[model samples]
Target: MDAKAWDERYAGTELVWSAEPNRFVAAETGDLPPGRALDLAAGEGRNSIWLAKQGWQVTAVDFSAAALAKGKLLADAQGASVEWITADLVTWTPKAEAYDLVLIAYLHLPEDEMQSVLAKAAHSLAPGGTFLLIGHDLANLTEGVGGPQDPSILHTPDKVSAALPGVNVTRAERVRRPVTVEGEPREAIDTLVRAVRA
Candidate 1:
């Protein structure tokens, strides 16, 4: 979906996603000391706001102005300060070697675009900075639940790992997440990758 589509989607009375940070995001970053962080494609600022409360100076970027506005409202309500930027992630570049932590969650794109964005994210990290990413695994399409069905946009751990050329990969694998579907419990697969710039 483009920015306009996303804006319309977020305009509904109900929240599209929960205000809490993604489970993988909280788990992967909970122990890290506070530092400058970037949340790319940060829809509604969930992770960005959570990071701010954790003492990290955060900048959250997303293309939808409506989404950003909603995020700003939530941030204000929570007393968490976050810099929300409205721009396309594909065109918006972060300062090189600036962020201590960079996060990308569920930003699905074609393989080439995904690689390009991941490369940019890796290069934006300072030496020793941590980069964490999570998204619906390609296997989620058939063997799991919830996510885009298009195979081109879905990704695998190996594919994601290959995109980060200059990083030491700490964790790059498909992980299972428990979810309830129509009152029945099931597992959803996701690709989780954590790396540090060398």
Candidate 2:
């Protein structure tokens, strides 16, 4: 969806996503010491606000102005501070080697665009900085609960690994999360990549 579509989606009374940070994000980043962090495609600022409360100076970037505004309200309510930027990830350039932690969650795009975004995200990290990414695994389409059905936007561990260079990959795999499907518990597959810049 484009920025306008996203804005309309977020214009609804209900929050499209939960206010809490993504489970993978919390688990992967919980132990890291506070530092400058970037949350790319940060819809509604859930992760960004959570990072701020954890003491990380955070910058949340999203193309939707409505989403950013909602995020600001949430941040204000929590007494958390975040620098919000409205820009497209494809066009927005973060400072090279500036962030101590870089996070991209569920930012699905075509294979070529995905690679470009991932490359930029890797370059945004400082030496020894951590880069964490989470997205719907390609397997999720047939064997999982909820995610985009288009295969072009889905990702795999191998694809993510190839997009990231100069990093020591700590974890790169298809992981499972439990979700309720028609009141029956089932596992949803997701691609997880955690790396540290060398």
Candidate 3:
């Protein structure tokens, strides 16, 4: 979907996504010292606002203006300050080595575009900065639940790892997330990667 489509989706009276940060993101950053953070494709700035509350100076970028507007209200309500930018993630470039952490969550794109953005994310990280990505794994199609149906846009550990050339990959694997489908409890397969720039 394009920016216009996403705008329309986020223009609803209620939020489409939860206000909480993703579990993987919280788990990964909980122990780190607060610093400058960049959240790409930050839909409604849920994670961005969470990061701000955690004492990180956060910049959240997404293509949808409506989503950012909602995020601004959310941040205000939570007493969190976040800089929200309306731009295309695929083409947006961050300031070189400016962020102490870079987060990309559930931003599915074609393989080439995904790689390009991952490279940009790596470039945005400062020395010793962390880059973390969490998204639907390619195996989620049959082995998991609730994700984009298109396999081409789905991610894998190796795919994400290979995109970062100058980083030490601390973790790159498929993780299981418990979810309820109707009434039966199930696990959703997700690809996750955590890397640090040298």
Clashes found in each candidate (C-alpha, N, C closer than 3 A): 0, 0, 0
Worst 10 residues of 2 by lDDT: 11-20
- What is the TM-score (0 to 1) of candidate 2? 0.97
Residue lDDT tens for model 3, 26-145? 999998899999999999999999999999999999999999999999999999999999999788899989999999999999999999999999999999999999999999999999
What TM-score would every model get versus the actual structure? 0.98, 0.97, 0.98
Error of 2 at 75 (Å): 0.4
Single out the weakest 10-residue window by summed lDDT for candidate 3.
Answer: 84-93
Q: Which ranges in model 2 have alpha carbons more than 4 Å from their true place? A: none
Kindly list the per-residue Cα lDDT of model 1 for residues 1-198, writing each as its tens digit: 999999999887667899999999999999999999999999999999999999999999999999999999999999999999998988888999999999999999878888889999999999989999999999999999998999899979899989997899999999999999999999999999999999
- Which candidate has the top score in lDDT? 3
Residue 192, candidate 2: alpha-carbon lDDT: 99
Q: What lDDT is obtained when candidate 1 is compared to the true structure?
A: 0.94
How much is 143 displaced in model 1, in angstroms? 1.1
The CA lDDT of each predicted structure is: 0.94, 0.94, 0.95
Off by over 4 Å in 1: none
